[model samples]
Target: MNKNKKVIEVKNLKKYFNVGPGLTLKAVDDLNFYIYEGETLGLVGESGCGKSTTGRTMIRLYDATAGEVLFEGKDVHKMSRAEHKDFTRHAQMIFQDPYASLNPRMTVGDIIGEGIDIHRIMGGKERMERIYNLLETVGLNREHASRFPHEFSGGQRQRIGIARALAIEPKFIVCDEPISALDVSIQAQVVNLLIELQRDMKLTYLFIAHDLSMVKHISDRVAVMYLGTMVELASSTELYDKPLHPYTQALLSAIPIPDPNIERSRQRVLLEGDVPSPINPSAGCRFKGRCRYAKDVCHQQMPELREVGPDHFVACHIV
Candidate 1:
């Protein structure tokens, strides 16, 4: 992917929900970022930090509360019915839970071919061949396509999910924690398959996960989120080596070092207090309540993401 060319642009994206009488929950609050074509942009944050919601909203699975998402220079939310169908065909998603994501009732072949049939891409023998090919592409066989999802193991089921995502031949995919539910041994296998598939397909990916280590391996760029706001965005190597935001530093510090000597010597940035509620976040920094270097201004006004270095962006008053 050319780092200069953006395939998807998310501008001031906000997604909220009315939980109850007069109460609102801000799931994703004013997020702004761009994903380059054929590149993996990692969205990392602690669980319930709006990572999944952002992916869903960007894909139009959930409507936006405000702001716009541009796909190849066209606003996704503003698309007409015909354009919306085209958008769906151009983009796909690999969900977190393979077991739950796959239909228990549908055969693997039918599940994978659902999109093909809906789009009327091919029918009968042609569609059957395509399903078989997709199964093989994801490391399964033609025979397994006739079986139900429950008959396969967790890893195999995820492969089926991958096959299903690829059935439509999408240019972009939102991988929402696709490997988090797999076994540690199986996680690497799935991630490797994704990387290989991306290279072969020239696919752009918005890979969302809380697992920093895995994200580093697959992503070209990484964005750190706190509560519902992005605190830092930079290349994977740069962000992991010299994290600018305090929240980012805290997150990277928690990744265990393989070397025992370095592990014991390195100081951990232990964050205090729980994550603040998104219902009504603090004024300035979303992480101010837990940040060690909080100042008066940090509570008075929110900080916008600013370019701190080449290809690096950070949203913090003190960064």
Candidate 2:
């Protein structure tokens, strides 16, 4: 978490999908941030807000249209084939849908051992042993390795997915809404496993999720995104306790409190309209249409992310 060392640094990263010659969808636009070594940087936003796109772009699943992504101070996009394969071993992703991500035809043993085989890191007996250990680490029995995806529950399948990711001994992982498809009770278990594994392995994480409560619990810092742009970034406690941006304040106001007295006392700050379309977005702030305090300047000019406090940044005219 030290400022001096960044495992992954993203500078003005952009990802756009081409719909046609004159049309494009800006999924991630001008995002600038860095993930400190061995820390979880929680990326929270509404669906289609580009959180997933940002993660995918960083891993090169979708080639970024602009900006630079550096891993350990090396440019990720410029890596050679051999270096790319090495990069894959160090950086792995646990996708949101466990059932869809895992192969239905492959046994759990094969699923976990696939990375080892591709990397040529181990032989037959050692690879099988590692797969068994991974299954055990994720709270699944060794015998279950012979079973298919359908044999496991939603939570168990997720554990299998996690086992696969960990099989490669990755130093960093992008958890793309990993628990969004699981039951509420099961979510905690998966989250706890990630936290524990991170501690044991000293791993860094780009945890992209919509669950603010879970994000608050798991993240060392949180980045708030709106309509493909990052609006605010700050320490988890600072962001939750004293949000500076109007958009951030509005978002936090919507989270429900358990206590009846506190819940009744709180007033929800609803935005005025839906998120603006990203395809050739209007010049100005992406949130200009719904920002409560947007002024004339907000509609005509875009705001840059500027530091407001130590390790705290916000982008908005009102901020």
Q: Which candidate number would show the highest lDDT if scored against the true structure?
A: 1
Residue 290 lDDT in candidate 1? 91
Worst 10 residues of 2 by lDDT: 1-10
TM-scores for all predictions: 0.98, 0.98
> Where does model 2 exceed 4 Å of error?
none
Error of 2 at 165 (Å): 0.7
The alpha-carbon deviation from the true structure for residue 130 of candidate 1, after best TM-score superposition, in angstroms, is 0.8
TM-score, candidate number 1: 0.98
How many angstroms is residue 60 displaced in model 1 relative to the true structure, after the best TM-score fit?
0.6
List clashing residue pairs in candidate 2.
none
True-vs-predicted CA distance for residue 5, candidate 1, Å? 2.9
What are the per-model numbers of colliding residue pairs? 0, 0
lDDT of 1 by residue, 1-319 (tens): 9777898999999999998887778889999999998999999999999999999999899999999999999999999999999999989999999889999999999999999988999999999999999999999989998899999999999999999999999999999999999999999999999999999999999999999999999999999998889999999999999999999999999999999999999899999989877886657878889999989889988899999999899999998
Instruction: Output the lDDT of residue 289, model 2.
Output: 87
Which tens-of-lDDT digit does each residue in 9-48 have in candidate 2? 9999999999889999999999999999899999999889
In order, candidate lDDTs are 0.94, 0.93
* Candidate 1 residue pairs in backbone clash: none
